[model samples]
Target: MKYISGIIAILLLSVFAACEDETKTCDSTLLSDLGMNFKKDTLQGFLVKDTIWPKVTLYAIGNDSVLINRQPRSSAFMPLDPLHDTCRFYLQLDSIAIPDTLTFRYKRVPSFVSPGCGFATFFSLDTVITTYNTIDSIHINNREVNSSNDTHISLYFIY
Candidate 1:
């Protein structure tokens, strides 16, 4: 009888241990919270502001869909000094898939321009729509142009 009782106690302890191990609390702030329903994969987007001088707007699109509406964001803009000729912007994404085509639209705000340029140019621009698959990375650059200097918008994505 003693031996039987000991075995029963051991079995009960083992059952309790197993139950404790099986209980797990799910994290509420997971990728699912972001609306990404992939069971075995995750998608994320990040924006990298390279500079704060010029102060332009940045937008992002994925699979020809506006992931980030053309919202204005600070961009690298400096006084039209002889030294500065080009403007740079950056955005980052991880574990994302690019659709067949993506479109980027940007408008530069003239308010950020210095007195060097006679009149601000708001050059509405769009990229040569192209498709992307398994895009591991991406970057966008708006070269110097003499056009309307309104808040500029651009699109970049990765898969």
Candidate 2:
């Protein structure tokens, strides 16, 4: 009975230790690789309001075709290629709206976190350009797209 109880206690301790170790992964990994805020410039930037369209879709501009569709969102935290200097996205407002391409130009810097946390990539926003179809303009509101959790870009849609 004593041996069994000792074994059980050790097993429990191991289980708890495993759970604690798993938490060592940095929370910065969950940070948005690129944060986007969709807004409508009421009176051409005098008053800006977050606009969530009912049928907006986002797709990665590559062969892998990562897609986020039919999501009504005012803001989004989308991932970008850590190794690539540029990230492009195809965005559509609705089924009938023309697909507009937004291209992000930036440089990725690898952050050396603790050994347990490993490393992460942070991007510095250089320029943002969008096709003037449904999108009116794109602005890099914040130049540093890092774990600071700030909106990196503001996208204005034609109102």
Which candidate has the highest lDDT of all? 2
Worst 10 residues of 2 by lDDT: 23-32
Instruction: List residue ranges in candidate 1 displaced over 4 A.
Output: 1-114, 126-128, 136-159
Model 2, residue 105: displacement in angstroms? 1.5
Angstrom error at residue 124, model 1:
1.2
Residue pairs that clash (backbone atoms under 3 angstroms), model 2: none
| Per-candidate TM-score against the hidden true structure | 0.19, 0.76
| Candidate 2: segments with Cα more than 4 A from true spot | 1-27, 30-32
Model 1's C-alpha root-mean-square deviation from the true structure amounts to 22.0
Number of the top TM-score candidate: 2
